[model samples]
Target: MKKLINDPKNVVNEAVAGFEVAHADIVRVSHDPVFIVRADAPLHGKVGIVSGGGSGHEPMHGGFVGFGMLDAAVPGPVFTSPTPDPILAATQAVDGGAGVLHIVKNYTGDVLNFETAADLAAADGIQVRTVIINDDVAVKDSLYTAGRRGVAGTILVEKIAGAAAERGDDLDAVTAVAEKVNSHVRTMGVALTPCVVPHAGEPSFTLADDEIEIGIGIHGEPGRERIKLEPADAIVDRLLGPILEDLPFASGDEVLLLVNGMGGTPQIELYIVFRRAAEVLQECGITVTRSLVGNYTTSLEMAGASISVLKLDDELTALWDAPVQTAALRWGR
Candidate 1:
């Protein structure tokens, strides 16, 4: 791979170091173990919010460390779950006697690791609650496997839950808000090209120059199907159709739309997707009260995009508009 780094194994550590130096005013790096938190965290007695996943999705778990967002973010290797030690440490650091809430994405490793951490924290009398985000509508539900994988909708969950915590809501209230938001959210993604993990040093999967993968998961997993590349409008139509049909939004329903690029896709292309998505929603008689389009969550240099629709009530809408100052997202300043 043509990546600038010291070593593949040390990439996560070095990246954490560089991030701390770059944004020291807003974030603080943990010693030895890899955990990030707001520079001024642990607001006495406020519920701590912790979320994390694999390392390739930068500015995600880490970039979201700051006021009105996550209190601590743990990092794992590329597309791997962080171990229980760092997560437990983060839970301890942010637990201000109120409790700690973990916003974990629905992945096998992530679920296992966070479960272990919760068990560890329970031993120390630190109250811990978890809300797994499974908003991707692409995966089929089965009794044997997880229903759906979490995707970009996680960002919305973190923001809304953090806002609730900042408002002095107890652990139960914060978790309730989190669960509510999780239920209201749905996401779907498509990929034009595959990404190469640094350790693997090769493309995770193969795609022709003109082919695309629909319903792609973030970690280079095979999508539901592969098809020829189409125009931006058609692309948006294909991406949005499944999500809309699955939920079947009603008239006068207010929704928050997120059009996220998968690393390599350009903002201009993302905007095109957003425009088409808005048109499709309006035609369906759904009202999009708020829209955000960009590379919020990303695969490692993959050329693709995902769309997430969050059906919002007044409470969720107010929380969505609340102030946030994370490195990856900033609004209502």
Candidate 2:
């Protein structure tokens, strides 16, 4: 309930306004039907990439709008999917004649809305493709999704796919690269505390002081189980076990390991988790070639973290190393 805002109903609008002003150099915002696009959009001949979901996960679809990432991002209300109108607007705004790709997380509302927008864009003569990200190894189905709920691994899809598009890959090629990333990546999260939506004025879920939820979804959905608080290494093992087993990532496999904060977890704690995760991977003979540890995708101000492992090949490794300039993630630029 304690948040800095003028009104609960206006949280998204106001936040979007602030974000526009703060990151103006890299992005431009459209108000009528809210959407964020790279400052220099419609990169003719390069495939346009767009992804979106609820607004709470900052620096996600929106912060990722820039060169070598997303061309456009449509954000809905907190933990809510955006309507078709804004999605279509974003699609049109980024279409540069080559095509547009929709990188949607596997949420029911997001999937349907993006599908509708894609059909509408197609009718307008814009070639459109869609890739559903289902990288969560936590659950096969959640209240918000029919299949495995997409989690932190979504950023991997957007980044890798955007790199392919930036390199002038065609629509099909970009979509293929996106699908490949989704398939190779696996993620699992643990929540120590729940987040409160601005409008709701109450935490989405409850957790005892010494309790934790393992395999949690980004939107505060029920996870695999709730258990007493354990050491950071033990929790990391629980999460990474399912991920490594699900992908069957074996010895000699190279990976890009991401230790992502849910929202409120500190950077120091994240590195603590990463240390143990790295040690475990080394023990298994898996090579941690690339690593990312931070709050890239979040759920408002929840105190938690998720671990993502992306099995990498030579092509994926190169694409991941490509230059990217975005509000949240900027390197090799």
Candidate 3:
């Protein structure tokens, strides 16, 4: 209930306005329908990469707009999918001669809305491709999605696919890379405390002080189970077990292990989770070649974290190592 804001309904618009000012050098915002585009867009002959969903997941779709990543991002309201008009606008704005790819999460509203936008863009002679991220090993269905909910693994998809596009890969190649990342990645989250929505002015869900919810969604959706709080290592085991089994990531496989915070967890705690995850992977004989630990994707001030593992091949490794300069992720540049 305690949020720093003028009005709940205007939170998205206002927050976006602040973001535009803060990162103006790298991005530009369009207000008519509200989408964020890289300041230098329409790179000729390069495939345009765009991904978006509800707001509140900071440094996600919008924060990722920049060189070697998303050329454009369309953000909806807090935990709500954007309509088609802005998505189409973003697509058109970023399209070069190559084509545009929409990286949608596996949420029903996001899928349907992006589909409508793709159709509209195709009508205007813009080739459009879509990839749906469904890497959550937590659940098969949730309130927001029909299948596994796309969780933190989305960052891996966008980064790898965007690198492919930045290297002048064709539309089909970029789409394939995106799908490959989605297939290789698996994620699961746990929540220690619930977050309050601005409009609702109350917690979306409840957790006792001594309890935790495993396999939580980014939007505070119901997770796999609630149990009395356990040590961080035990929690990491609970999450990593499902993720590893779902992908069956084999021994000798190289991976990019990501320990992501759910907005509120501190870096100290995140590293604890990562430490245990790395230990488990090492025991399994899975090599952790690349590693990322931080708040990449998040719920609105929710106290939790998610661990993602992307089984990496040489090609995927190179793509991840490529230069990237975005608001949230910047490296190799």
Candidate 1 lDDT tens digits, 117-186:
9999989999999999998887764221276888899999999999999889999999999999888889
Q: Which candidate, 1 or 2, has the higher TM-score?
A: 2
Residue-wise C-alpha lDDT for candidate 2, range 199-297, written one tens digit per residue: 899998899999999999999999999999999999999999999999799999999999999999999999999999999999999999999999899
Candidate 2 overall lDDT versus native: 0.95
The C-alpha TM-scores of every prediction are: 0.97, 0.99, 0.99
- Give model 1 RMSD, 1 decimal: 1.6
Give the alpha carbon lDDT tens digit for every residue of 300-320 in model 3.
Answer: 899999999999999999999
Q: TM-score of model 2 relative to the true fold?
A: 0.99
All candidates' lDDT scores? 0.89, 0.95, 0.94
Candidate 1, number of clashes? 0
- Candidate 1 accuracy as TM-score: 0.97
Using TM-score as the measure, name the better of candidate 1 and candidate 3: 3
